[model samples]
Target: MDELLDRTAEAAPQDLTDGAELRGSSFDFLTGPGIDLAAKAQAFHAWAQTRVAHGVFPYAKRLGGRPGATAELTLLDGRCHAGLNFSSQEYLSLARHPKVCAAAQAAMERYGVHSAGSTALAGNVEEATALEAELGELLRMPEVLLFPTGWAAGFGAIKGLVRETDHVVIDQLAHNCLHEGARASTPNIHLHRHLDADHVERLLKRVRQRDPHNGILVVTEGCFSMDADSPDLKRLQALAREHGALLMVDVAHDLGCLGPGGGGQLELQRMLGQVDLVMGSFSKTFASNGGFVASHDRAIKEYLRFYAAPNTFSNALSPVQVAIVRACLAIVRSSEGGERRERLMRAIQALRGALTEQGLTVLGHPSPIVPVMLGPDALARVASREMAQAGLLANLVEYPAVSLNSARLRMQVMADHTPALAQTAAHIVADALQRARALAGATH
Candidate 1:
């Protein structure tokens, strides 16, 4: 225990006060000085290596095979642990579907895996074109443009359409990509409180008073990944319309995983085809690494094809990737998709209930994510190590990823997660927390 807690020999006394404390290890990478980039990483690496030795680092554990309710995780020491997996973000469990795999194989046979060029020139394939049409139909939008990844889609959607003169009114808790895209394009960015439509309204009104003629793009997410909550999109869209602003919703986490026919928040809110722009990723509920943006105007599609650097410069989604997503979409729209959503909801409820029964404070509303809040950051690190050792694998989100002293476990569920697994996992988590709190309490 002494060896596990000792600082590295070269660590300065200041380091002992900083990263030697458990709370500082997670922030070095986030708040570390960028002037000497390698120095920042070196400091973080020193602190993180100690966490690894203590088996509490809990990042970048390689997977052994296909992901599901349970998976084989290979730790840093080359030891494999098979545990109840709650780390994967796949809500639909479609990654290993037989039809999806078969579609990939067929597309590989036809297109030889790669798309061969960027979509702006020669990489556009028939499968992707058909996918765009299908997504347009599913989203109930007039046009769709595909991107290489979900991140690219979010970034490009804002970067492509909004000019430097345009103002962006975004949620405070919006995804990093959206913030980065807005930062890259313009300096006129206003952030409102998270999920506060009234704040959005005030910001919209403020921006209009200052620059009535300039375009204002209102950005938000359909589902916040960390907290498992959603916003009132209907009121937000109306606010944007009243203020003469464009509303764009990023459905990366919820699309194809929520709402009727897997149409996501817009559909459930009865605002499908009503928002000015919609963007989503296939990696969440669908079975591929791709994304798309939908709009009610054809000009947006044509404009993005040429203007969006990701679409014009980057290689389009491979034929196999497109085919895999196409197959997943077919299932997402069918009666089987409805059944899977029901199963997913049940699994979500079961896991949340199990956690609550264990006396853990579960955050936000019920969704695939059940955030079990563990405070003080230090306790979360200890609890993470205990959970890993106890053969229960889940993500340990601490400072920077969340906030200081608000660390929590973001347990993601799949459609196929069984009730028995949920109950057992909850027990393991509870036991881990008990033991961790005792050990951390004794350390003082």
Candidate 2:
């Protein structure tokens, strides 16, 4: 039976071409029996090289400066153009702020750029301590533990705290790092539908019925970046409390972009201190590299600080990054931050409205991310290519990132995007969608 299954699984080789890849590659490197991994990689490289020469594959274009709302992008054909950047996560536009730059320079001068060792061994610098303390205060948490990067934070928090005997129930659409953390921590993992409280409750009840004594962690995001929607925090909290489980929320996308005072989804939902744990990234809104896990439970904080691999093995965030984050946090808590938040919201609303008016399907509720759902992979690829040709930079979400049939053009809005730019972006995107539709139909 095993041999029969193996024999049946083999796929006949077919001619691979650019058109096939743009429509979605049929290659399955994982399921291929005794597959030549190196050869497959070479094949993919050839395909990518072909696409890059044509200016349709826009993975990473060489950037001249800080990747802001308007910056220079070097295309695949080696031609540089000033493009309207809708791919940046600088919601508050603090990346180029004078104060942020000044703080970084001062820190670089004082600390000389490197931390030299992890915080555990060398002790944290003054800026690191200040940043952690400020984050605790802003998030209204008793303690906060910082990681070198947001990816490390998500992966470390779960792996450090959750034991092998523990159970973790996560949203199906949670970030990839969170999924990694959950899987690495324990084998007893359950997935709940995105934002489906009922599904979570059912899973929780089932787990409780089987292992009432084991610790259960419920994981979710404050604002799902891909979908640009938030869960009902109040309901989720209540459910977790009723089930004797702890809830962890990642506010990486919304922490410094949404809510009053940029307090994030917890603040917007009025559940700041009610949730068990809150984690986020400073890179998005604070314009720095690092992430933190804030919680009232001091034991969990200490455990993560000591056991988390990133914290234990990885070097601490540089003094410059720490300083920049400290300065950005101060601005985010000020009146200027409030004004910037309002401006960001205006851009989001205007762009979403325009896309909808153009008869395009816009996904999610009100947020800085405006994703125009374009269904087919080929269609999304064509639209993105057309948009770039028109000097607009947007992100393409396709297979593995999202469902194959749910490909989208993800546009990120910044607070400093002018009204004229926004209007022009809308028209360009509308035209691109129209052209992509025709091209896709013709190909079919």
Candidate 3:
């Protein structure tokens, strides 16, 4: 494993140099006397320029310039096309709902655009408190806390909950946020094979053998955003209980999509009450920008509220966003919301079936997110381009998001999509797949 990783790392620089040339530029004035900061800045800028020149730039070219790509987006050529937006995390199409938008607009009128301060500061504590309480109830947790974003939520929870002496076992395919957070928070971290509970048990036993006094935390995601699959939560909960470890599940992708009542995969598995901690993003299903950690224990919630840097330092969620989320929550909790969720599931199934009939390989279970496996990076990029041309907006996910040679198209189905629209999207994606296959065949 180490040798393979080393080889990949060694090849990264070589790959960067294939299509671009790097030129050395001098900055004598910036490095001259009485310019300490300037020298450092110049050095960093030089490194950055070299990276970009060597084809290591990470930013995707934004061809479609639009607020939301449900119908059309203006591409890099400044032309409009019928766009299928598979990249958005808004799984339920609640972002553009009239109720959500109206609430946001009303909140803007009531409290301006920004939160203006952190939650610990003079920001709207009332809204924060209310949101935490509402989230707690929705997630079946005793208490809840919010962070500025999902990245911060993961980082804060792992760091705040575990000590250096604690053993953190994570899924191999867990989101980078979880792995990175655990790595930053504790030195004793082990990664197990994806969704393999037996591997987790083996690692837990090894950790216990090495350090019997150390605490253990097992981490996994409810629905993997990239692959759209879920871990066996019931078995995971039982394993955590047997090992005296706490289990943390990130439900960013499944929070408003899965379960019997839209609570998530844990809920669907009837293990919601078994998991120790649950974290999810409000951005996707709730159609709001923020992240949260929900727990049955009050102490844990209080600890994170004070210890989490993002919660204490970052500005509170904007009042408008809070209002929007509040509205979304109301809608999701009602019977009408159940109907919407059902519609979403049906749409997902329909699209998946159509894609399968068209002979395209789709990953994961029959979830709202249907990932079309395109294999190579070049093929994935070409398929994405073709789909865009055909009036479907799909995301071309490549390396770093998934393993090398596992590039795919991540298609997210929304509740608002009609049957015709969903079928049309599948056909467009199928055509795109054919084109990509043809191009690859010719090249080979």
User: Can you give the TM-score per candidate against the true fold?
Assistant: 0.93, 0.93, 0.84
Off by over 4 Å in 1: 1-21, 30-35
**Residues 230-267 of candidate 2: C-alpha lDDT, one tens digit per residue:** 99989988898889999999999888778887888889
What RMSD does model 2 have? 8.7
- Sort every candidate by lDDT, greatest first: 1, 2, 3
Which model is ahead, 1 or 2, in terms of TM-score? Answer: 1
- Superposing all C-alpha atoms, what RMSD in Å does each candidate have to the true structure? 5.0, 8.7, 8.8
Model 3 stretches astray by more than 4 angstroms: 1-69, 75-80
- Which ten residues in a row are the worst by lDDT in model 3? 3-12
lDDT of all predictions? 0.84, 0.82, 0.74
Total clashing pairs for each candidate: 0, 0, 6
Q: Model 1, residue 29: what's the lDDT?
A: 71
lDDT of 2: 0.82
Give candidate 3's whole-model lDDT: 0.74
lDDT of 3 by residue, 215-327 (tens): 89999999987888888888888888887899999998888777657787877888766788999888788887888888988888778877887788888788887888888
